[model samples]
Target: MGPKGPKVIHVGYTPAHVEQVFFPHAEVVGDLGLSLARLARAG
Candidate 1:
């Protein structure tokens, strides 16, 4: 478990793989952006 909750399993893939898998979803843009923003804030 992570700080907030249970962590997601990435399953046999890297960043590029997951990005490609979610490419067709419109929410991907905002989701990825939020993820990057969170990382930036954490750093």
Candidate 2:
């Protein structure tokens, strides 16, 4: 074991995509959600 570098967290992208997005220097995190949602209130 040795010193570590920056910590990364992926939202919803594949490993390959994540690597590309982070320039192949980031730790990949699992998907967060499947679908997005929006809420509205009546006045």
Candidate 3:
């Protein structure tokens, strides 16, 4: 969706909330990142 590939976005949640829904890759970004990922974006 951007200049690279599909755009990845975060719906605005606390780091804890994001973690509870998804895995963490950067304490917070990990969840948002993986949510939009097509591969192993969490690792």
Candidate 4:
């Protein structure tokens, strides 16, 4: 992996503290099913 990599999408129950420390710029989606559906459609 280089500077540019696949987009990181974090779904469900991600607290702000954890998110800030770990998933900085990740796309945080609350609904797991909805997010999966969207990803499937996009693919």
Local distance difference test values of all predictions, in order? 0.42, 0.39, 0.43, 0.57
C-alpha-based local distance difference test score of model 2: 0.39
What is the overall TM-score of model 2 with all chains considered together? Answer: 0.23
- Tens-place lDDT per residue, model 2, 1-43, is 1125455533344554633335444433454343222111211
The sequence of per-residue lDDT tens digits that candidate 4 reaches over residues 1-43 is 2236544555665533443335434655567788778779988
**lDDT at position 41, candidate 4:** 94
Better-scoring candidate (TM-score), 1 or 4? 4
Best TM-score goes to which candidate?
4
lDDT of 1 by residue, 1-43 (tens): 3345544533222342445233322122236566667657977
**TM values, all candidates:** 0.31, 0.23, 0.19, 0.43
Would you list the rank order by lDDT, best first?
Answer: 4, 3, 1, 2
lDDT (Cα, 0-100) at 22 in candidate 3 = 51
TM-score ranking from best candidate downward: 4, 1, 2, 3
Better candidate by TM-score, 3 or 4: 4
